[model samples]
Target: METGAEVSGQAGLAPYPVVEEVSSLLNRPADEIDASVSLGERADFSTRVSELNAKSAAGDPAAFYGQQLLLSRIYGLVTQLPEGPTAEGSIVVQEVLRQLEQATIAAEDGMLESGILDAAPAEPTAFLSWLKKLAKEHRVYKHPYYREFIRDQATADDLRHYVIQESVVDGRFDDLLAMMQVGTSGAAKMEIAENFWDEMGNGDPSQVHTHLFNQIYEVFDISPDELERSLTANALLSGNLAVLLCRYRNLYAEAVGFLGMTEWLAPDRFVQVVHAWDRLGLPDIGIVYHKLHITVDSRHAAGWFHNVVVPAAESERMRRAIARGTLWRLNSSARYLDERMPELASHR
Candidate 1:
């Protein structure tokens, strides 16, 4: 719950000289530099750096940005090493330089974003309203790709591909819920745990959402092994990566935004998808997952928006992060559907 500053405290870990240089280069204050590099005391510096590296390797946009910032700071330090610093510099300095080189290479290979730190913030209400408008206007249910699939334009193989890809994505639901639970307290923690409980069926084996979803796949003859082995689509992968970036970075407002939009939009989106399954004459057992989301997600969405996003997003940066998370979800889904639409038409 604490900001990186609050958890790590202002004392003790003074900014390294290179970090200060980076701060000056970026026109940011020393404290901001410290926070950027500190990333809070929740994990050691190396471990956090490693995690960021992994996310960058996986193509997470935010993580890529963070990696750039981190590497720039380290590079600044490398530049400050003693003039005698040849390839034969102190082992410590050499190792730092080695890491800096690797990170720079990675950044060059990965997606690049400029001025991320300078992104203008927005008021929470305006940001949330923008997200709602975006969602309403670009609703996945309204997408032609989905409509075509629902209209029986897609072959059984196409439908099976979709089901498998989605089931693989759904398998991450519990993990996402658990990740969002971190750094929360009191009512927030309680609500999140309740959501987790609902997801896991309050510890009852039969009612678990994942199990219910698995049953739906079974009706399609998509064996659990098949679902597990399915390749993740890029859009789904990016969307999940965005959520994980927010969680790992402890970006609380972004996490709230991501979760809130997901809950709010699930029912609206799933309603059509579920109807499509029925139109295809799939068994009722295979449709419960969609039915369950339509019934439960509205309440979850409202609760999250009022209790979490509204209360937590007090700053422009936080609000902007929230907006980014929401848009990331919407846009990614849109892209996913668009890419798959042609497959259905081609099948026809």
Candidate 2:
């Protein structure tokens, strides 16, 4: 089986004219190509996907086509995996394929009309209103599942599970922040760096975000050891993967857009959670994480939107990337919350 790196090299060497290239390479019937290609003797399909991903990151015109083809191949392969198409990773891949298809069509259309591609990006102030409206209708905000959870319908175990899963997701913020700094200069870099500084507790060892969160768990008498042992929900895992995908692919503006939207929406989503905790008589110290974010993240979101996302979004392609990234995050989060709601309700 070819490694992803190897397949990536091949993908760059020639444009795929048909699906048979992948089928022939994997020794699977062209019509029956499926996720099973990634298993057993053909297990190199995963590597091929990774290789195609690297090409996509390069921003070459052919890279998008390669990614579309590679993803389609992987889509087939994952569908045939032992766990089948409904598996967590498969679902993520399905969503990705849908997005990639849309992007591919948009990119082709934009290439034919240079005017649309070259039009000036929306100004930050104008963009903020659009973003706000997006947030207002975002599934994370409007979904009944999240509302129920926020209304204190969740059991203690469910709450603990949520906290631990979120910790796992939030722990990756450093990586996302670093990605945002790439190709940035002057005021943009400075603004992002400050956000990073705050996230890291402004150089204070004892006040790091992770440590503060740990303190919150301590206040609730939830054992840190148990938190570590807790399993992460698939939805959270996929959501994190989507963010990292943008980062790893060097989708800088898109990454900033996603992160900014997350920060902007944090307060609204978390305020309810904080109220629930307070009603339960959980100490203030246990809930400071959410409280602190309400103010800090709002400012951070504004800074990132104006400084990073706005400037980089100078083209239609970039604007679309930003929108895709934001929606990807929002939808994944909603799915995560929705999945957990059923489990939590079972406990009730």
Q: Each prediction's Cα RMSD? A: 15.1, 12.9
TM-score of every candidate relative to the true structure: 0.61, 0.60
TM-score of 1: 0.61
Over 4 Å off in model 2, which ranges? 1-124, 217-233, 342-348
Model 2 lDDT per residue over 6-109, tens place: 13322233443322344343333333444443454333444444444455445543444455444434443432243332323443344444454445434333
Encode model 1's per-residue lDDT on 254-333: one tens digit a residue. Answer: 66766777788777667767767777787788778779888778888877776667655566667666766665566556
What is the lDDT for 232 in model 1? 39
Clash count, candidate 1: 0
